[model samples]
Target: MTELGKRIVNILQKKSSWESDKERLLKEIQQMEDLDILQDVWTRYERVQKNPDISGTRNDPNSLLAYYLDITKEKPEEEFKNEKRRTYGRDGWPDIDMDFCDDRRHEIVNFLVGKYGRSRVASIGTVQTLKSKAELRRVIKALDPEKSINYTAKKPDQSGNFALQNEILGTLPKILKKRDGTLLKNLQEVYNEFNEFAAYMRKYPQVFETAKRMEGNISSSGIHPGGIILSPVDLSTLCPLHTTRGTNEDGQAGASKAMVTQFTMQDVESLGLIKIDVLGVSTLTTIDFATKLVKNNYGIDIDLSDLPLDDPLVLELYNSGKTDGIFQCEEAGMKQALQQIQINSFDDLMLAVAMYRPGPKDYIPQIAKRKQNPNLVQYAHPIVEKHTKSTYGIIVYQESAMHIFVELAGLTPTEGYTFIKGAAKKKPELFMSMKARFIKGASKISNKQVAESVWRQMEPFQGYAFCAGHSYAYAYLSWKTAYLKAHYPVEFICARLTEKSRRRKTDIVYKYEQDAIKNFGITIHPADLNRSKLTYIKIGEKDLLRPLLIKDVGDKAAEEIIRCQPFDPDDLLYSFGMKVGGAVNTKIVEVLASAKMFGNIPKPKVLSIFEAIKAGRQKSKGRQTGNLKKGIKGTVKRRKKTLDLDF
Candidate 1:
C-alpha cells in the first residue's frame, strides 16, 4: 500500500477497533499492486469509519468486502471520479463550506473557545477610516463655513450685455454639472479649478492641509465580522484585548460582549497569530432546512454532496434563467449572464462565475459567442492552446495566466506567480522587467515575436482574474442549490421563505413567494390561526406563510398563538390577555383579523368580540374586589367562553 493508504488504514483500524477480518482486509489492501484500486479501498474505508450509518456496509463483513470489490471493479476513471476543487489559502479554514448559519458560526467560535480556553481565542479588530467623499465634504464645509453656499461666475457672451452666469457651488460636481463639461470631475479638480472661486480657496491652504491629514486616518475601531484569532498562549500576551458590545439583527445594542484584538487582521498575521474567518452563509442554512423539509414531506433523504452533475432539470433551469435563489447566481446580472451564456455543463457554470466580475464582465459577450460557435475560437500559439483551451482560447482565470507564463515563457512557478501578482497590481516597472525576462526565456524555446504576441493577448487579464479552483467550488454550490430547487421546488421555496423571514428580509421573502406561486405553480396559504407555524411550513401540496410575517404580530405572539391551537375569537382574546399572559395583545388580534385569520368572522366582528371580552373581565374583577371588601369571600364560577357575537 502507499504511505497515505497505510496511515489511513492504521487510523481506521484504531478507530473501528480492528477485528481479524479488518486485519485481513488491510493485508489484502496492502498487498494490492494497483495503486488506483488500493486508493479506492482506502477511501471507502475512511468514509466507512467516519459515517458508518451512511455506508453500505456498516458492520457486516461480507458487505464490506463486496463494497470494496464493487468500487474497484470499475475502470480507474469511473472508480476515482474527480470531485470539484475546493481552494484553501494560507489560513486553515476550508473555503468551500465556510457559509454556515449565524448561530452555527457562533457555536463554532464557542467550540474553539472551549477547546483552546477563552483567553487564547478572540475576534480580530478592524480600523474604519475616512474615504474620498467624506474627506471632500468635510474640507468643503470647513472652507466655506456655511450650510449652503452659492457662488456665481460670469463668462463673456457674444452679447456682452447678457453674460452667462454659472453657479459654482450649486452646480459643482455632485450638486450639479454642465452636460458638456469635464472640468469639475472630482474634488481634486474642484480644488485645482482655474476659476476665481477656486483661486480664492487657494488662500486658505490650511483647510486642504487639514483635510489631507484627516483623510485615511483611523476614525474608529470595530470588530471584524468573521475573523477570529487564536493564539497558543493568552491573546493578551500577544495583543491588547477590549470588550466590544454586539448588536442584534435589528442593529440594537444587546448585552452580549466579545473580546476583540486591538490589532487588525493584517497586524495579527504579522504577529504570526492564526486568524480564521467563520462566515455566516444563509444559503447553507437554507439547504439544511430544505433537506429536512424534503425528508419530512417526501421521505427522500438527500445527500447534497453526492448529487449528479448533469441533471436535465437543473440544466434546464439554468438555461432558462430561473436561478433566482441559486447561490452566487441569484443576482439579476448573473441571471442575465446565464441566459445569455446558455450553459450546458458545469464547466460553463464555472466560467460564468469567473467572468461575471466588473473587469471580466466585458468579455461575457465574446465568451458566449465563442461558446455558441466553437468554430470562432482560436488560440494565439501552440503553448497558449494548451493552457487556454479549457476557456475556449480566452483567459478566464489567474491560474491560466500562471500556466501561460510557465509554459510559453519558461518561467519558474515562483517567477510566474510573481509576474501575475505584479501585473495585477499594474506595477509598470516590475511588469517591464518581467516582460524582458519572459521574452528572453521564450527566445530560447521559440521566437521572441510569438512570445510578444502572447504577452499582448494576456495584458487585459492582468487587471482582474479569478482563481479557477475557487470558481469551481462556487459552481459546485450553485449546481447543488439549482438541483434542489429544480427537483423539490415546494420544499426549497418553503425553506427559502423561512430563511428570509427569520432575517426579516421582507422584500426577498415576498419575491420568493411571488416566484413560487407564479413560476412553480406553488400555492401560498395565508397565516391561519389553527394551521400556520411560527415559520413558513410545507403542507401536503401547499406552503403556509408564517404568522410572524403578518404586520403587528411579533415572533413571540406567533409562537404563543401557534401553541394554543383551535382558538375562536373568545379564546384568542382570553389567551392574549390572560391565558398566555399577554404574549399576544389587542394589536396582534386586529392585524390577524385584518389578514382574515379568524375563521369566517370579519375584522369589525372580531374587534367587537374583543371589546366585549375586555368589559366582562373588567366587571368580574370589580365585583371580586367589592365582594372581598365586604368580607363575602366565596368562589365565583367564571363564564364559559364561545365565539357567538353578532356583527
Candidate 2:
C-alpha cells in the first residue's frame, strides 16, 4: 500500500469513521503535500495514466466556477447588440462582453421556483407571466423607471415595457423590461425559500416516510440518486459540505428545484441532506417474485425465516443436479454438471456453485470424474494442493487469485484482496498484460521464460471474480431456499409462487404448473372467482394448490380483486363495483378472469370486455377533449387583446 493509503487506513482505524470523506478521497494529495510526497506520487500517477491534466483539477475553484457559469451562458449574438467577442481579462478571469442580465434573471426565477414552490419562489425573474399592462408597469418601475415607461415615444401612452428593447427591440410598454437585471441578493432569497420548503416538508411525516422508504430505493421517479439537499446548519456543522460554488457531490449543475424539477436528481449532494434516486433493478423484482409466491401457498403461514442454513437435501441436490428450484441451479448447463458430481457437502456445494460457470465449468467434468474416482485426481504441487484442496488443486474463484497472490507473490492481505477484486473478472488478455508487468517489476525472477509461465498461471484468477466469502454467502442463501423447496415442496413452492404478481404473473403460473404442481402431482384447478384465492391457493378437502391462471387476468388486477372481495370468485361483478358505465377494462377483466370472476360466462361475453374497455377509454378521452376545449376557450376569452409589447 502507498504511504497515503496507509495513513488513511490508520486514520480510519483511530476514528472508526471518515471525517472529510469525499473531500479527503478526492484531495488526499493535498494532505501529502505537507509531507513532500505529493509531487512524486501525483507526478508518477499522471505519467502512468498519461494524463496531461492535474489529478484533481475538479477541485480548482476557478475551473469549477467557470463550469457553473457555462451552464447559464447562451450565444452572445442572441443577447447582445451583435455577435462579438471582446477580449479583456487574462487566463484566470474573463470579462463578459455582453450583459446577460435577462438570462440571469430567468435562471434566478427558475432556481427560486424549484427550491420553493412556484407561489413561494421569486426572483426578479423575467416578467414573462405578466397579467396586464399594470403588472408590466410595476416590474418596469422596479428596474429603472426613468429609462423605461416611455409615455411619449413613437406611439403615445407607452405605459410599461423593457427599456433596452424599447430603444432597440421595441417600445417600452406597461411591463417589466426583458433586461431587468437580478442582484446577488436574489440568490439569498432563493436559498431562503428553498430552506423554508425543506423545513415545511419536514413537518409532514408522510412525505418523510415516503422519502425514507425511497431513501436508498429510488424508482422511476424521484430526486437524483446521489443528489442531496443541504441546509445551512447541516452544511457548516456535520461536514464541510464543500462544493464548487453552486453544486454538491451529486451530478448537479447549478440548477435549483425552482429552476428545473429535472435537476432534483442531478449533481448536488451533501452529507445530512436527503438523496433519492429511482433505480431499476432485476434483483429486487426477482426477490419480489419469490416472496409473493411464498405468501399465497400457505395463507401467510409459510416461514421463510425458518429455512435452515445447512440442509442435507439441498446439499445433495447441489451435488446431484436436482437443483431445478434453486436460484443458481435452475438453468440447463448448471443442472447437468451438478448431476454428474452429486456433491456430498457444503464445500462441495460451494465448489459446484462456483465452478458451474464458463471459466470454471470446463474443469467440472474432470473434477467430477476425479471425485468419482479419486486416483485420477492429480495434485500439481503441494502449494497448489494447499491453495486448491477444497476444490482438489484447481483455481476457480476470486479467492483462488487472492490465494496465489498471498502464497506465491508475497502480497499483503489488502494488496491480495485488491488484486482479487480488480483482476479476477477481467478478460484473459487483460490479466496476461497486468501479470507480465507485475512479473517484470519483480527482481527475484531471473529466467524470463519461467517468469512468463508463472505469470500465465496467475492470469486466470485475477479478473473480477468474487471473494470466496461472498460467493459462499450467496450459496448459503441458495441452499436455504433450495432446502425449503426440496423438503417442504408444496408449502415452500406455494409460498414462493403464491401471488401471480408476487413474481411475474406468468412466472408464478409457470412454476405452479411446471415445477411445483407437476413435480408433486398437486392439482391446479382453474381459477373460480367464487372459490379462488388471489395467491397460490389451496382448495377445499382436496387441498389442491391452484394458481391464479385465469387467461385474461394479470397479477395486479388479481390482487385488487382479492382485496376487494377476499377471493370469492362467485361474487357478482356489479356487487364488486363493476358499474355499468364501461368500468370493465382489460386490466380489470384480466384480474377478474385470473381470479376466475366468471364461472359460467362464455367466451363471447368474456371477449366483450375488450370492446367495453375500448369504449370506456374512448368516453374518457371525449370528456378530456371537452374539458381541454373549455379550458382553451376560457383562457382565450380571459386574455385581453388590447396590448402589444415585444418581450
- Candidate models: Cα lDDT each: 0.64, 0.43
| Residue-level error in angstroms, candidate 2, position 380 | 3.9
lDDT of 1: 0.64
Best by lDDT: 1
Clashes of each: 0, 58
Provide the lowest-lDDT 10-residue window in model 2.
Answer: 75-84
lDDT of 2 by residue, 268-384 (tens): 231223222112222223334445544664555444424554667666656555455566777878888777767676667677777777556777888887787778755533454
Off by over 4 Å in 2: 1-310, 319-322, 413-422, 425-430, 433-456, 462-464, 503-508, 540-560, 563-583, 586-597, 605-647
Root mean square deviation (Cα) for candidate 1: 10.1
Q: In TM-score terms, which candidate is top?
A: 1
Task: Provide the lDDT at 194 for model 2.
Answer: 44
Model 1 reaches what TM-score against the true structure? 0.74
